[model samples]
Every structure is written in C-alpha cells, then in structure tokens.
Target: MKFLFPIFALCALLSSCQALAGSQAGTEAKFAPETITAFAKNVEKYAAAQGAGAFIIGRIGRPQQELPKGIRFTHTAIAVYSAITLKDGSTVNGYAIHNLYQETGKPDVSALVVDYPVDFFWGVHELSAGIIIPTPELQQRIIAAISSGKNKAVHNPAYSVIASPYNNELQNCTEHTLNIINASIYQTTDMRQLKANARAHFKGQRVRSSRFKLMLGSLFMDDVTTRDHDGKVVTTTFSTIGRYLQQNGLVKHMAVFNRDGSSGELL
Candidate 1:
C-alpha cells in the first residue's frame, strides 16, 4: 500500500509535463484553440500595457493536481516585443516568446524556439499566466542581450526538467531563462562567469527529497538528474527567478493573470 503513492508520483513526473521548465509531447489542450488565442492575446496586451518590452512568462502546462509540491507553473520562457510576420507576409507589432522547448518525442533534448503567445499557450491545461516584468533599464538590457545573439549562445540543448542554476552541465527552460537574465545583467556571454554569478546570488528551489523518490528519479535520469547538486536537489524554477529579480530591485512587476483578465500576486 505504501508503494502506491510513489508509483503515482512517478507517473505524474513521467506523464505530460517535465517539471516547471517545459512541456513534453502528447499533452492535450484543455481550452479550444480560439479560446487559447484570446487569452494569449490578452496576456500579450497586458505586458505591453505595462510598458514591458521584454518579460519572463510562465504557463500551467500540467494539471494543478498532478504538480509536485511548491511547483506552480509548468513552463517558462521569455517574451519580447517585436514585429511579428504573419502567414500573409505582413508584419504586426507584438510580443514574441522565446522558448527552450523539449524536442517532440525526445524529452531529453531541447531547442531554442521563437513563437508567439498563441503558440506558447496552445497546449496549456489552464488559462492562467505568470509574468515577471523587469525594470525599464533591465528590460532594455534583456532586449539588447537577445538582440546581440547572446541568448542563443548561452543555450545548452541538453535538457533536464530540474536543472541546476549554479552550473551549465544541463539546462531546462527556466534555467535557460535565468542564464539569459544574468547574461543581460553582466553584459557578457561567458557561460563560466554567468554560472559563477548564478552560484553567488541565485537560490534555486530544492526538490523535496526521499529515498524512494530519489530512486525513481535515478531510473529516469534523462528527465531529472541530481548529479549537479552535491547536497539536496536544488533546481532553478520560475519562482526562484522571480525572487532573484525581485530581491535585486530589477522587477517592475511580478504577477499572475487569469482568463478573466484578473490580476494577482505571482509568488
């Protein structure tokens, strides 16, 4: 009977979602495409209304009931204001999401993808959105960093759902987002120094550990690994990134938005 809980936990981890970093293949959309498009449009509009040229975005990729303890959003990435080209070859100004998406059918590998908000939220289970807007100066810096191609240079395609922020051994979407943030701040694309800065100031979320859970994780090391941490399993998360920017006085707003366009505290 005691083993049942661990089995369920393992199922949750191996199911449609991969931690709070990115979504896996075979996930279904709870909302219809039109509904998703509307909600995504509103999210993009909200960020622009806040004067956010660049911001961090998170989504609830998995069912809330299946999420692990202390994990809220399931996928996170960066959104930048840009002129987006449509299928008709006409361009419109809006926010474009930059994602480190786990390759379809290959959960262990990821790729940097530039998509719009509708594409970002297309597979979400819920209509909720998490947003972290950096201060104006920081926003400009982030935009500049991405513009200079530093964001792409810092991306490590080796994907782990619970990747460590203090090292570049493996990376997920959230860790990648944090890496780009630090790159923008330090004004350098030096991966080693960026990792050093993260080690100095970042506080990653510690995955609640147990002997049985650790055993299960080991069996699926391709998806979740703790070799990066000598102690507890400390992995970068959306909340950790929010806390880092909030504490450093680089955040203009940290908030959550519902489908109804209501606003609330994120963390």
Candidate 2:
C-alpha cells in the first residue's frame, strides 16, 4: 500500500524500470513438445492412481530473480480428478487444474483460471514435477470448495512474485494456493481467518536481501517496498505450502515425476 516512487525515480535516473521488468520476465517455461507430452501422460497416471478425486500438484519450473535462494519448485496448482457433466449431458473426466494466472500486458495483475494437464505443463521450463495426493476425506472437501468458486475468493489479484506468508495485501502463485488450501480445510475464506490460519500452518524461511537488492526491488516492483518487506524477504513459496500440508496430515503421499521415465517419493 505504500509507494516509493520518489526513490524509484531517483534510481530510474540511474537505471530503467522497464529493463528491470524485462530482465525478470522469466515466468514462462520452454520445454520441448515431446517432453510436454510425456509429462502430461505421467501426471495423468498419478492422478488416476488417486482413484477419481482431487489433489494438489506442485511443479518445478522456471525461476525468477525475485525468488529467494534454495527454492526449487516455483508453482503449485489444484488438480481435480473427477468426472464432470456438461449441459449437453456429456461427461468429461480428467485432471482439471486450477491456479492463478498472471495476464499478459497487465504487469502485476492476475486471476484464477483452469488449465488441463497438457495445457498446465505447456511452457513449463522444467520436466520434473511434484504430485501431492491428499487423503480421501480431504480430497472431497477440497474438490467441493474449488468447484463452488469459494477457493478463488481468497486470491488477491495484486500479484507479487515474492509475496509474504503473513499478509493478504498482495499474493504470489504459491501464496494464493496456500490460502485457498487453508480456507478449504478450515471452512472459511475470511481475510482475518486466512491470516490466522497461515500464521499457524505455514512454515518456511525467507532470505533477507542485501541493501543493494532491496534498493533494486523498491525501484522496480511496486509491491516490494521497504516498509512491506522490511528487508525485501520472501517466505511464501512452494516448499512452505508442501511442508504445511505434510505436517497437517492432509497429504497421503508425495511423488516426484521425472522426464526420464521415473518417479519416486520426494524425501
């Protein structure tokens, strides 16, 4: 909510913000067509193994400079493995992945959108992915909440590639997924409840950026001001959400899918 345009202008006099945005435009992952097809097939195998339900699938893809150190997986999405009916009395069955998508040309704006397994893996920079299959009881609640549009309500459109786990003023992809997951489990989407639940369930580390990095962030990113980050640190990431789910007994098992025709527990 705080603006550092004065400092931004001062810094821009030395460097261009447009250049900074351009340099950080590393969200879209570029994988080969064959790799994408294999990835989708593998994802389907794992989803079907869950036996007709919903689960959370995390992907390790492209990285951005804004993300902190040692964070491998960069994105998380909810995949519903169920048969859906259409108005024409037709039935569709497959993994329907839902996640926040940052629109083109909108800069820091994003919204929740659905993507199929193949569509989800398209442009993913990496071929490895982590699949977290929830227990049967939890899967039903998760699928219902997401299907009813209650999950998207917890998302904040003001996207930040490095969003904090403590606040809802802004959100990143992983942070948005964490909120929706928490809301579904806790049965509430209220802001205060989400913040409280995050404080309790979410756990991870954030690397405090150096003074120079902080200065760069303040100058380039509107949501990355000094007051908001204190030191331009980021805690809400894919690993954090995974840890929360594992600790809370929501997950049945976790498997890492590789492009080399192999899969195993994340460990």
Candidate 2 regions exceeding 4 Å error are: 1-29, 63-67, 84-91, 221-227, 230-232
Q: Pick by TM-score: which candidate is best? A: 1
Tens-digit per-residue lDDT, 206-230, candidate 1:
7776645655765875666666666
Q: Model 1, 255: alpha-carbon shift in Å? A: 0.8
For candidate 2, lDDT tens digit of each residue in 1-267? 247876665564323222222212235548776768777987788668756387777665544343345565666778887675667999987788888766676657777777777777776656777787777877888888888888778888886666677788777677777777877788998988888777766775574455565566666566343343544465565566666778888888777778875888764
**What lDDT score goes with residue 22 in model 1?**
56
Instruction: Give the alpha-carbon lDDT of every model.
Output: 0.84, 0.67
Model 1, runs deviating above 4 Å: 1-21, 24-27
Best by lDDT: 1
Residue 254 Cα positional deviation in candidate 2, in Å, after optimal superposition: 0.7
